[model samples]
Target: MATAPTASNLPLFYKDLVPLSSVDHADFHARPLDSADFLINQHAVPLTSDEFVSASRHYPIVFSAGDNPVPLALMGLNEGINTFVSEEGKLINPVYVPAYIRRYPFMLARLRPDTDELSLCFDPTSGAIGKFDEGDVLFVDGKPSDAVNNILEFCKNFEEAGQRTGQFVEELQKADLLMDGEVSIQADGYEQPFVYRGFKMVDETKLRELRGDVLRKMMQNGILALIFAHLFSLQLMREIFAEQVKAGKMPAVTVAPTTA
Candidate 1:
């Protein structure tokens, strides 16, 4: 169960959102994505179901803690630390970028809770959007321009992917396959290892005990493969931890007893 995203839960760098409208933003335009420095501080980026395979190749996909468990790509061991991003805001490695990050500055959000309708919105502070004389126009002839239409299409696809991700998470929860997640790393010259917890992972024991019909269904639906991808990606936790050490950002505390 993924937690409902609130304004607080919205990704970093998104601030002062206003619904995009032809009437209000007739002259709005967007510049090219010139830099990725904004993503430097994000240690984990949300992952949609469609991203599992490619994301698994680059990042350790793990479920966030709590009743609502959104899949997250671990970029760093600790919060506000993205080791993959260099000082210049460029990605340090050639890893698959999560759509959540790629779709930034533009998001489909429900302006009100009573209605299910979503509105196209953007971060006014993002600097990528403005009333620029050059760049992709957001509106033309009192209607959305091609750029705006494309952004809407992307948002629509993201919403659909989010729905699929939710269903996948629901299946995992229904089968009670989730267990508390933990990881430990012992960096060189460090006597005690650093331990990380407060996440969830598939319980292999529970998964193996699933009924034949359920297992078969999961396999047929490709959920089983996704599960394995998640499991396999856990091995990257050590790699991420090592990167943190190399960056001189290792945690100060020593390992403690594993927590659930």
Candidate 2:
């Protein structure tokens, strides 16, 4: 087994990155939920500049399930959360676009929202990142593992539907291109709900630069530091769970409590 990480093993092993804070909680919502719903109602709402700063100041890491707050990771960078702080610490809204989606073939073309202006969208049905528009109907696929499959299917369905309606054009097909980057087979499947620490949001330009830098450093590091940290924290939770099992303090695999 890999040695458990400690303060001494860190920053160096992780390329000098350290978590801003840590949480002692052992609970993780292992059953994957609808990411689209979590992103919209829990994530997109109440993300004002004031709330970001206030929450960040109170805790170096801020987590949310929709609008609910939670804890940070023990180490490394966590998920990318919308931010209200710049590198200089000024309050500003941070727009988020995952590197995979940004570089993915469809996201760059057919998947991109018509407007360059940043907005939040929760769509498990789309393989590409999407921006929300008023009155555009959305469907939720609650099964997490099926999320990506649904997205791929949606694209195929969309193309077929467009053709049936005479909306398909050869020129539009030209716009469909995937980023040269590959999505890891390991990355397949729905992600369970969990805590993220030190998620900072930035503008689209800044996000692009940061993501590029992170991607460049990914192989050098196991995972990007932020994502690595979150993964590490999840592993740590497993460790905690294992220890608890040994002590009979908890069951081997405890399902998350639906309430509180």
Candidate 3:
């Protein structure tokens, strides 16, 4: 099956992306990411399987639509509505921030479709990045600085986590446990309930019917807990919808009964 494009398919908040080559970006430096307002417009963020435990505590974790499903942490139900991010871009909730977000402005990318090699890249348009008089330098004496090395390490870790997440999804797919998910919420004074769709989720019935050996293997590998975390997080969808209503940012759409 062909893979579907994900929210992270292209680097978000990246206006201009250039490979961090010593010859090209020799004088580049990176300023501290002091604020998170950049994430305010992001309604959903990609998540690695490792983030399920902590992410489930705050955002609802669901699978993105695609052949190779990627987990997503939903900050809000509607577009341009990140309930966790304040107007100031500060995170309103004290929850585990996904590594995908923390590694922003810096990520590993394949410059060409034909190549398997990944390069360290950064968003040149980000004001936080530049060759300013004061900031962490990207290279020292033509060599990568400690700060640059640290960023590389973080991106490497993120890539590894993504691979693990892919394996988890593959296991679920092999078991045929994923199904289209929907949720309905009732708001006061609203005659009909708001229904949301277009996301994938684990089917509890199929999961419960798995072979004993398969279930034990999943438990031993800790995938079972992650699955449960995702299931439990679905309840937060209603809460996120309520937050949108409270903030008066809910999109104007007709409410309809949920389909089976």
Clashes of each: 4, 5, 1
lDDT of 3 by residue, 207-260 (tens): 989999999999999999999999999999988888998888875774421211
Report the lDDT tens digits of candidate 1 across residue range 95-119: 8989998888999999999999999
Candidate 3 differs from the real structure by a C-alpha RMSD in angstroms, to one decimal, of 3.5
TM-score of each: 0.92, 0.20, 0.90
lDDT of 3 at 137: 89
The candidates, ranked best first by TM-score, are: 1, 3, 2
Comparing candidate 1 with candidate 2, which one achieves the higher TM-score?
A: 1
| Candidate with best lDDT | 1
Compose the digit string of candidate 2's lDDT tens values, residues 51-123.
2223332222212222222222211112122132333423233433222222122211222458653211222
lDDT of 2: 0.27
List the lowest-lDDT window of 10 residues for candidate 1.
251-260
Clashing pairs in 3: 37-89
Which candidate order results from sorting by lDDT in descending order? 1, 3, 2
State each model's CA lDDT, in order. Answer: 0.84, 0.27, 0.83
